[model samples]
Target: MENRTPIPDLIRLATTTADVDTLLQMMETFCHHFSYPFDRPLRQQLIRQMLENPSLGSLWLVVDENRPVGYVVLTYGFALEFGGKTALVDELFIEEGHRGGGKGRTVLQQIQQTADELGVSVILLQTEKYNPRAKRLYESIGFVDQERSTLMWKRPN
Candidate 1:
């Protein structure tokens, strides 16, 4: 039998302003690790928006023994191709110290279960090309590569 780490009991939704700071700190760490530029102001605004509107999305803090270990973000959208409501796993980060040991896999499994309960028809996510470890972890949890290229256009700043 394979030994697995039990899911922590501290996965809590970020529903209050008090959670913003903690989320920002963790997000900064995540972006830095991935070499993504951290736009603090924009991220702060987006986080607040999600908090104010449950219909928009949700943010969850992954905690272990009362300390935050990582965070996940899910944004809701409607997709005809998906047959209706879809969830984009906008961000999922497990701190370096907490990497491995089955935490990431467990969290993703929980996300799928939650999405099903919420009537989401599909869940989508993208990983960086350089981060094969993350891609493998996601695939191990049943996430598949759609083989479609993703393109984005940012509004002129």
Candidate 2:
């Protein structure tokens, strides 16, 4: 609680691991955006497995007035083209009930500050093609649309 603020608590990378369960629950709650495997234990295991990997990512929960309102997950990346480290904002979510109070913006600005502190040149993020609201939020916070799209392959197939 050292960096805790009145509305947006500022937590560093390492301090967030203890709240992994809350993070997992939040992900599961956003079922539309998440494909949950449906067992608490499995999710907990996956969360731990992720935390153990240095390159996997770090999660920060946005606690406001003592309750978690949103969260951010950032993973590191290197771009020889950009010539330094960049951060991929893998997931950012604010609960539906907490949607429009400027809390999201505050939390994101904190993320940007974190990126700056890490000497990262850019922050990469993506939103659903249909999530116009989210796109707008990101744009307002200086996140620009990348000229690229994602391509992927099934991991266990």
Residue pairs in clash, model 1: none
For each candidate in turn, the TM-score is: 0.88, 0.76
Error of 1 at 135 (Å): 1.3
Compute the lDDT for candidate 2. Answer: 0.73
What C-alpha lDDT values do all the predictions have?
0.87, 0.73
Q: For model 2, where is the 10-residue window of minimal lDDT?
A: 6-15
Write the residue-wise lDDT of candidate 2 on 1-157 in tens digits. 4985554454435345558868777877765555535577786776676678856667777776777766788888899876788788877777888879887778778887777667788878877787798889989988888667574668795
lDDT: worst 10-residue window of model 1: 4-13
Best by TM-score: 1
Residue 122, model 2, lDDT:
81
- Candidate 1 CA-lDDT value: 0.87
Error of 2 at 71 (Å): 1.5
Off-target runs (Cα >4 Å) in candidate 1 are 1-10, 152-157
